[model samples]
Target: MRRKILKVLALAPFALLFTSCEKKISHEHREVHWDRDMCERCKMVVSERNHAAQVINKETGEAYMFDDIGCVILWFKEENITWKDTASIWITDVKTSKWIDARTAHYDTVHQTPMAYGFSANEKKESIVKDSEILNFEEMSKRVLQRGR
Candidate 1:
């Protein structure tokens, strides 16, 4: 009985140490279900392979999927997400349909998007016409906010 009590006490701190630590949240993009997963804001099925966006709360590592950048923009306004400035936004490259860092990717505002946002992300993978204007993340967000649609 004394040996059993000592063993329990010896392992208690290790158990406590493991349990007390907070679960680490991943800042990376989550897997998309494509045509099955619904948008967090608009509730539309995320079917557009090239236009889907996901915003991950940097602090909590929670990902909110969106069918369009327009929905993402409006969701920021509607929800007043406190972590907006620090959030990690992921968007698919227009040509490759692969996830890319949205904040760092260049955008051209000419394509027809799912939500009519008209902004397509580029990792320089999508060939643009000569002298086509490219917008940064901040600029694109401002334009989307200004459009107010």
Candidate 2:
């Protein structure tokens, strides 16, 4: 009986350690604290509510937040991370201040952004300002990369 009790006691620490070491997988968008949260790319404080963007790695459940859509585009290329279907890309809609899937969002290059990439996302292509062409995610990314080079 004493030997069994000692064996059980020895296993308790390992069990606790295993549970404590287990990672809590979270892939959801976390609320950004404006002025407090810094952009992952430019290191600027995310003060612009409508320009904020985020990339969440669905596999690792890690999130990288940015101050603008332009910053996110730059970071996405620089990181050399695969743009898999599982990756979640989110952008703030300028008109509604709501989060929208960047894959389907339309982008305009006339709007002033934090990194001066002049890109903004909108739910509708018609919402884009005049003189700016509505770009899909791939087109916007290419434009941003081209401008960076």
Q: Please, what is the TM-score per model?
A: 0.84, 0.77
Tell me the tens digit of each residue's lDDT in model 2 across 1-149.
99999999999999999999988877667788889999988889998888889889987888888988878877867877786457888999988879999889998877788878877889898888787778899998888888883
Q: Please give the range of 10 consecutive residues that has the lowest summed lDDT in model 2.
A: 76-85
Q: Pick the candidate with the highest TM-score.
A: 1
Each candidate's lDDT (Cα)? Answer: 0.88, 0.84
**Candidate 1: 10-residue stretch with minimal lDDT:** 124-133
lDDT of 2 at 125: 89
Runs of candidate 2 with Cα error greater than 4 angstroms are 1-26, 83-85
Q: List the residue pairs that clash in candidate 2.
A: none
Native-to-model Cα distance after best TM-score fit, residue 64 in candidate 1, in Å:
0.6
